[model samples]
Target: MYVTSNFTWHQLAQHVGGIQLQLEEKGFVKGDVLLAITPHSSFELILVYLACIEQGVICALVPELTTLDLDKRIQTSGAKAVFLCPNTSLTLDGALEIDFALEQGLETQNYSEQNLTSLIFTSGSTGEPKLSPTACITI
Candidate 1:
């Protein structure tokens, strides 16, 4: 169950579906990484993740930092696209952008699973930062 300041599960599912269609239509086939840079306070962040997963895309929900290291992470992620709020000035050439303005739900699906679905960067408060990728092991 997700509890946002003023959000519902239907809203989440609708947003997720729209994002899924947006990514797939942009040629985000299996095994592509989708970068998401947004504050944790944003409820749409969760929708972005769920959509990417449905499309078999790797969702790299990086932390919000104003450092060159962010560039390095985006580069390392090899993201085919990035999703965030519309008003933000975030830009990445050759990567598809999905904005909040297009949050209306769309029905689409092409699910695929890889050994890795996400790559996390920890809070530097603990340390500089670490790349801890979660690998899915199928037995």
Candidate 2:
């Protein structure tokens, strides 16, 4: 499924034309992992989330998270892989990088009755942050 931010779909298809075709011909069922690293655009986060739904793979999105936070999220999400931007760096136990240019495409996934997706994190208000979980699902 080549899960990525909004502007990279075209460029990703261009680079991995063979792989993309293989996926499409096989009903786009080859994808089982996702990597999202859009620092400047929230659209990237949104796109990746939708891609996860289409591909039926678990997704983990962490925005400007600290090293400790990254470790915790990765652990909890059990993400098979991670994709980060050129400028973003994260040190974790198991993470890989895939290179693709920015491109555009139309989103075709629908989520009318899906459960709310969210991550639990510390609020960091006091010396020790309190853990809170929020859901963003649609009915």
Candidate 3:
């Protein structure tokens, strides 16, 4: 579900719940990772996690983490794609901010268990950010 506010969690959940039931009726297995890049309070993050669980995919929550941190995590987990919010922006290697916009309608994609869900960078408590694998089951 797409959302622009933290208060939208309940509404998004209702929408996604319907979609999940529909998908189940179709006999399609849920994907393994619900990737999110929005702020922690955003409803999208919550819906993604719920959807992942309903579909049996792992939920990965990655936010405000540096690219270096992301790189380490991605390399370690082999995540297929990172789910990013359309209006959000992040700086890349050249200081350019990349923005991903969500489409206007419903969309679905297939994924495998081998796919990386999310890579979490360690907080440098050990002197460096370490990547950790995030999966649906881990949620």
Candidate 4:
């Protein structure tokens, strides 16, 4: 499937706000871990990442989409939920289906520079994937 977007900055912000609300309403709270298995180049993936950031939820952007890879990620991240690609038919336990159509909003959160934001994993050429936790650093 092809991914394209024509959203302006204002529209993007609105979408992000809506996603944040969606996440909050779904019982996700600060420090909760989420696995984003959405397609790497998709706009929905971008929204998930931003919403998690604003909500102070730790998100791991999974690099691979295979079932085995996903299972490994879910296990290692201890994710509360998993975000899949829009057209995905895979049924995973704890999968969170997001509605980008939301317009409700929530207040932005203040995050510390040391706050764990995301987890980056290696390709595991040596063995099991190695994790690199990324922090929210404000310049």
Give the number of the best model, judged by lDDT. 4
- After TM-score superposition, the amount by which residue 134's alpha carbon in candidate 4 deviates from its true location, in angstroms, is 0.6
Error of 3 at 112 (Å): 17
* Residue pairs with backbone overlap in model 2: 7-103, 8-103, 116-137
Q: Give Cα distance to truth, residue 16, candidate 2, Å.
A: 12
Question: Which residue window of length 10 is worst by lDDT in model 1?
Answer: 130-139
1 versus 4: better TM-score goes to: 4
Compare candidates 2 and 4 on TM-score and give the better one.
4
| Tens digits of lDDT, candidate 2, 1-139 | 3345453665544434432332233343322434444455443344445544444443444565677765555565554666564445545444443323323233333223343343334546554433343333531
Candidate 4's C-alpha runs over 4 A off are 1-5, 87-89, 108-112, 123-125
Q: Model 3 segments beyond 4 Å from truth? A: 1-14, 17-31, 91-124, 127-139
- Candidates 1 and 3 compared: the better one by TM-score is 1
lDDT of each: 0.66, 0.44, 0.49, 0.77
TM-score of each: 0.67, 0.45, 0.50, 0.82
Clashes of 4: 0
Better of 1 and 3 by lDDT: 1
